[model samples]
Target: MSAQSTATERRRIAISALARELDGSNPASSAARLSEMLDTPRQMIVSADIDGLVSAAMLASVAPSWNVVGLVASSSKWLLHPSVSNEPPAGLVAVDLFSLNHDSISNHVVKYGAKRPMLLNLRAEWQAWDAAVAVAAQKRLFAVPSIWAGTQGCYDDAAKADSSKWKYPLGTAQILLALLEAADRPPKFFDRHYLPWLVANCDGGVSTYTKYAANARVWWAVMAGAVGPASLTEQVFRLVDGMRPHDFLDTVNALDRERQASGLDPWLNDDWNLANSQATTIERCLRWLADLTGWRDPLLGGIDSFAGWVEKPVKASGAVYIGGANVTTKSTEAAAVASLQGARSALNANFYHGGFSGSRFNWIGGW
Candidate 1:
């Protein structure tokens, strides 16, 4: 099917509009503006991660006309992705792309030279609120800040973005869920299965899960009629609490059912499960390590332990490394150094950044 553009489409809603809409006491912004953008027919480019996958699926379930064109984690992939790079359709929109200090506008969107791209980005929800605004201001894009809580949507300038206004740690998926509630279309199931993997991928473990789990519950509550504009934190834990995964597709079988029921389009024309989806840093690093150093270790308690073991090689030519779940960029760097210095076993070191995964290394580079 060919892409079509609407002649009379309005630009993206203002941050002030979202700020008011999300505010509980003064619910000034009508759902029309936000809903208009949501209901716009388009092909979507989604982040190749849990939150992005969940956001797109939920969107398709609600806006039956939209299509998903690609699942990419990096900006270069966003441009060269086979589904979009060669003959991209019109009305292309990118949703929830991870910002590992990536300037997508300068990188690809500006040079796209097709129809303007619509973006729903919340990377500023990390800390650099002004950075997000900068991306939205480019001439070649139709941008709206998708942030909900911290930074109160955005800061007008860079100087004010000093620190975060976060009351609790949360993900962009929850923010989208809240906005969906405002749009009066709520997804059926806020997944629960692969929620742990995000934390594991972050090396934050269950504690990271504990910190942000309530954000999912907040979305569920909005669906249940709590309100729009998700709050920052939960002062106390209710019995019901939260552990929902914004991600869908628990299994290959379950994905089939979800698509049939939700009428969701294919993910970059492919189907996958929790194990080896979203060819991001975690998977890329794993493959690179295997090729570079040939790690054959099993889960040795955790990755920190693995890192520790790799750091101190006792006159051994080949150090046995462990792998489980953890990351500290410094530790990873040190271990990479150890791999060369102590063992001289590996030919080279492969570096990776863990920012996009919502890990402790948010926006920071590492080995």
Candidate 2:
């Protein structure tokens, strides 16, 4: 077989192997399997994008012994958020990351309240410091990195390096000084100082890290746009529009294998971020594959067919705004019926029961 054919065969076999690992039967075993895949602590913390976030919640659910704290937008508004509902599906606690004042966070850290705190997005610098201080105060609280910071290669060096062992003491010191001189530390400092150390220490250097981060940005944008502002979402889709199909598929396939092994569902679910992320990725991969083979997605047609194929579905797939809901059924037909009934039940129960709802339904054959 040719090189291309051999690669394709390898990917197919890999995907099948991964699907078994992701069978969703035992989450603890799946998490253990996932832990083996990460070479660095940063990967554990930074890589939890959409599917990663879902897998974290799953592992927390199955392993109740490990305390999982979810950092949300607010301490006061969290109860109002749908996350207060049963969607996390287990003993995961959602807390306002900002709730603990400086004193409270310090006190909480000393107590080591949460075992592993999961920060899905670190939009600003202070958030990173907040996570670091919380985790550093207690070694048991795993130091998790941000999706952008971890995957981007900026934080990987510090994350992977043993602070006790100093290879380039001078360089490290300079970076530290730069970090302290907030104004002098340009955004590029991360790209310049830390990326070199990461490349020198890790397997893949800046180029490899760049490719991964770019792909992750695309996946994140899709999930974020599902509940976030449209303008921000549109900008992210445009960011990776020019990425080669082969490269994009390679990343998706790699992630799919890992996600499945982690016991993340591949189907699209309205409530599950991991499932929705997988579904959207699958759609994007299929669209790219079609274009590479000179086949147009009949659903999308335009002058720049490839661009049309890429942009339309990404925007449309996540456009249907819906709140989080936990759903399970034996098949797609059952899912459809259950979802419809659940919506109606929720509405009626809310109207009659004063904004509170409960559901217990039976399917055909008592499934």
Number of the predicted model whose TM-score against the real structure is largest: 1
Q: Tens-digit lDDT track for model 2 on 12-111?
A: 3323322332222333222123333222221111011222222222223223232222211111111111222332232122111111111110001111
Worst 10 residues of 2 by lDDT: 314-323
- How would you encode candidate 1's per-residue C-alpha lDDT over 1-367 as one tens digit per residue? 1101210110111233344554434433333344565566666655545445545555666775665554443322331223343443444555554221221101001111111112212121222333433453342232222222222212211222211211112333444545555556654443333222321222222233355442323222332243433322211112124424533224335545655686644332222323333343323333322232222311122222322221111122222121115422334545433432332121111112123332121121111
**Candidate 1 minimal-lDDT segment of 10 residues:** 105-114
TM-score of each: 0.40, 0.21
In lDDT terms, which candidate is top?
1
Decoy 1 TM-score against native:
0.40
C-alpha lDDT (0 to 100) for residue 56 of candidate 2: 29
The Cα error of candidate 2 at residue 290, in Å, is 29
**Candidate 2 clashing pairs, residues 3+ apart or interchain:** 22-260
